[model samples]
Target chain A: MANRVAVIGIGQTHHRSKREDVSIAGLVREAAQRALDDAGCTWADIDAVVVGKAPDMFEGIMMPEHYLAAALGAVGKPMFRVHTAGSVGGSTALVAAHLVAAGLHQRVLTVAFEKQSDSDAMWALSVPQPFSAPLLAGAGGYFAPIIRAYMRRSGAPNDVGMRVAVKDRLQALKNPYAHLHLPDISMKMVEESVLLWDPLHYLESCPSSDGAAAMVLGSEQAATVAESATGRRPAWVHGMAMRSEPTMFAGRDQVNPQAGRDCAKDVYAQAGITNPRAELDCAEVYVPFSWYEPMWLENLGFAAQGEGWKLTESGATALDGGDIPWNCSGGVLSSNPIGASGMLRFLEAALQVRGMAGEHQVEGARKALGHAYGGGAQFFAMWIVGSERPN
Target chain B: MSKIPATRQGHRPVAIVGFSQNHSVRSDSTSNEVEMLLPVIHDVFDRAGLTKDEIGFICSGSTDYLIGGPFSFVTALDAIGVWPPKSESHVEMDGAWALYEAFVRLQEGDLDTALVYGFGKSSLGDLDEIFNLQLDPYTMAPLHPDLVSLAALQARAVIDQGLGTEEDFARIAARSRRDAMNNPFAQIKRDDDVATLMSEPYLVSPLRRHCLPPISDGASAIILAAGEKAFDYAEHPAWITGIDHRIETHAFGARNLAVSTSTAKAGAIAGVGEGHVDVAELLTPFAHQELIVKAALGLADSVSINPSGGPLSANPLMSGGLNRLGEAAQAILDGRATRTVAHATGGPLLQQNLVCVLEGA
Candidate 1:
């Protein structure tokens, strides 16, 4: 039988536009140290390390893991690097989980981060290709047109995107680690903000952040030790799935990507989730842009294709009233560290199940979903975690 | 006071079913990354007697710095036409690590067949400057030490330690190139005398031009199947008995440059000494490092090393490691060897190492 795995420890650096206080190694070490402290384990206890990040160009490094081996306490141990664009963090976590699940390692430390302050992401992302049209503007310029297509296809009201922008920020006020603390955030403020990507406003976009996220995943036996040591339950992993498609193809639906749908379906099947909307206590879905909240709601099978926006319109996805609250920790809209953003979702989900989310805790949450998508929405990774171990 | 004793868990048997690669080129300006991968992917799939959909998972390895573009692997997915979406992953390291990821994923028993591939166009950027960025940014990268200079430091340490000399480096390079004559895909093939090669101008002190691997543009692919399905694909599957990788400290000065502790550790865990090794394919970027790896792996004079010429004949950044595994498996399939060990190294000066032991029943 395969070994059962659990998220024994979770930690994150205080997300900000620029972490000038630390170097890349220092930034990751902060998160790794915190996670190790949480798990009551030293670096020597870890059997292996798996690190993930976006493009090496973002930090002007080739394979940063090599240089970081000593700082990460990965010397004389196995260290692997995962890269799948924005989904890298989620993928990295899943890989670490597999190391435990497969009984290859007793305890694994996984870290994901992006120090955007080290270099310009927009410039790095827009490097022209040989036989393709150049991406002149940043991610917004490319995603704005897709947002327009969603609005036209679903006949969504213009304010749906604005509402998500406001709701996520309001939740951010309660999250101390969140980069943005918009106490006065409102639809009016989002509407009045400059339209950087036509359909999306400046306030609606995710901020560029320099931060790192780390998790200590262990085999079931290690989890027992961790629980006894910390007096906290481990977040038992239920199921995980990853899917990918080509970046471009004729008639490909960019609005609700099939890859995202398939990934959620596979993971849901593994976790025995029939109706995600009613089953999952909460969700930490990647919503870099506010409008993605509803779009992903539909793509992830939370609601019908056109009904996704209606859920947001009913204020049902908000932290105060909604049963199936999404991104209660303000999500990517609050803190976007590119590579670390997805793992932040995974960490936040684990926090919810462990009853350690503090201010953003979903009351009595038993299970939660963590989701992320990357590239031209061609890559998707998702996992379900429960307070109780799965049979 | 109870704990689960540390044990190697979930040993799901898997085998390399198919392997393929394109001819290593110094610069093939006509084809882009995807175009270069299309034929190799098809060749491997066809060789394995499986279709694209038959693959339960797809994992790739490549770096953006090699191509000077982010998400290069994204467009490369087009070569497979993933309309219905496929389980996939990518690593920023060599393809061998991608193989390692897939190997771990297969152990879950939920997936059986996986396609692993890696490609890089080293001709695109100033590789020396780019590789320097892999160093510790705060301390080492600022110095801009080129790869040759770093390898020279390792070579100098080897000579100083009395483990090997400049002539030994020349002999390894000469033998590697001579062996490349049998490898149609190898980039550099020559049969020259070690003494004559030693007389050539040194690119870096104690390192002649032949001591370094060619900066080649290439792609490599392998198809892996688990358990019974492994025998279904190949008559003599290269059964992966053991595979393990380990890394050492990045502070090269703190490491014993004459020896590779990581490779030795990986080899020990991979059971390299448990069986009589018939053939070995080691990924050594510099010639002197070959001697270091051989000693680390504990290969005796009976072992046939680099029958496929190895990385010294043609080193593609991301694909070089996978190519070594492929070459070793090919040796097993070709009736040349029944048991083989393959090694891959990453980071500056063999800081990280992966070892895989394959055998035939």
Candidate 2:
């Protein structure tokens, strides 16, 4: 039988447009050191380290993990790098969790980061390839058509996205680590922002920040010891799932990606969640654009098709009074470091389940979901965590 | 103090039941990355007597930098014809690490079978200029030191430390390429002697062109089955008795360049010393690295190393490590050896190393 696993520590660097003060290694060390401290253990306690990131082009460093091993105290230790596009951070954590769940290691450290200031992601992403039409658009250009398709299909009001942009920025006021703390954020402000992509305003898009997120995953035995040592509860992992599909094919639904749906189903089955909106007290989902909030709501089975926009417009996802609050730590919309975005969501979910999400905490949030998607909506990873161990 | 856990005992037995690879070439213009992968994917699935749906999990290894595009692995999934969506994951590292992930995933016992594949087209771009980006951005990358120059530095260290001379590198190159004559998939095959290779011009100080691997386009796939399924997939399955990987600091200047401490540690954990190795496949990008890696693994002269020519004949960047593991497993299935050790390396100067011990049942 697989061993039970728990997240004993969580740490993240303050999201910012540029981390000019630290080298890439220093940037990651900031989070890893904090994670080690929170775990009440040293690097010696970690049996392995797994690092994840988006395209190396984002930082102009191919396999930066090689240079970072020394700083992460991974020398003479097993180190693995995961890259599944934007979802890499979540997958990286899942890989680390597997080590503990398989009884192969007692404690595992996982970190994901993106140093976007090192290089221009737009140019790197626009590079022409052989035999394929060039996609000169940055990520926004590619997703704009999809957003337009969603608007046409759902008949959602244009203000729905503006509402999300305003709500998330308000949530960021409570998160000290969030990159964009717009104290004066409002729906009118979002409407006044320039349209970076069709149907998506500048305020709706995620910021390109430089940041890192780290977590210490421990086996059940190690978690018990850590809980006693730290005088805090560990977030027990209830389920983990990953799914993938071809980027382009006939009948492929990019709006409601099958991969994301299957991934959610797999994780929910493991967590024994029959109704996601009711069972999952809150969620931290990958929503780089404000419109993705409703899109993912339907894909995650939180709301029925075409009705997901109703949940967003009704103020049900707001951190202050929403029943199933989403992205209470401001989410990717407010602060995104590309590669670290997925991990930040996963970390935020763990924080909520453990009641460590201080100002952004959902009252009595006992169960939470962390979700991520990447590669043209083709790859998905998700996990469910709770305050109590699963039966 | 080395903190490697003592190799665990009495684990679920997993075996490499099927393996396939494409013909290595200087540049395969006829086939794109997906085209190169389809045949090998089908071959492995057919050899395992399974279909796409039967495989419980799939994993792949590749990097976007190789092809100068993002999400290369995303399109490659089309080769598998994923209609219902599949349980899968990917790594930025070499396919050997992909195998490692699958190995760990299979250990969870939720899945019984997995398919792993890796591919790279080194001919896509100027690798020498492209590889410079792999260095430490704040330190080494700014220097614009290409990969050959870096390997030359390691070669200089080997000679300076009296580990080996230029003649030894020539001998390794000669032996490896000559062995390639027997490998139909090898990109570079010649029976040239060490004396002939010694007369060649130096690509870098103390290293000749022959010492480096060819810029090849290739892909490899493997099918892994755990427990009783291993028996159902293959007649003589190459059971993975032990496997482990370790990495060292990237500051190559701070460490002994002539030694691979990471490989040595991984070899010990993989139990490479426990049994007699009849054959070994080492992923050595440079000819001189063969000596450094052999020493690290504690392989004896009697061991038949690189019987299939190895990376010196054809080195496909992301898939090279997994190919080494596949070649060793193939030898076991072919009745060439009862026990074999396979080693794979990544990063500069063999900074990262993985070792696996396979035994025939």
TM-score of chain A of each: 0.99, 0.99
Residue A151 in model 2: lDDT: 88
Which candidate tops DockQ? 2
- Report clash pairs, candidate 2: none
TM-score of every model versus the real structure: 0.98, 0.98
| Ten-residue stretch with the least lDDT total in model 1 chain A | A245-254
DockQ of each: 0.77, 0.78
Find the 10 residues in a row with the least total lDDT in model 1 chain B. B1-10
Given candidate 1, what's the lDDT at residue B66? 84
- The TM-score of candidate 2 is 0.98
lDDT of 2 by residue, B210-232 (tens): 99999999999999988878878
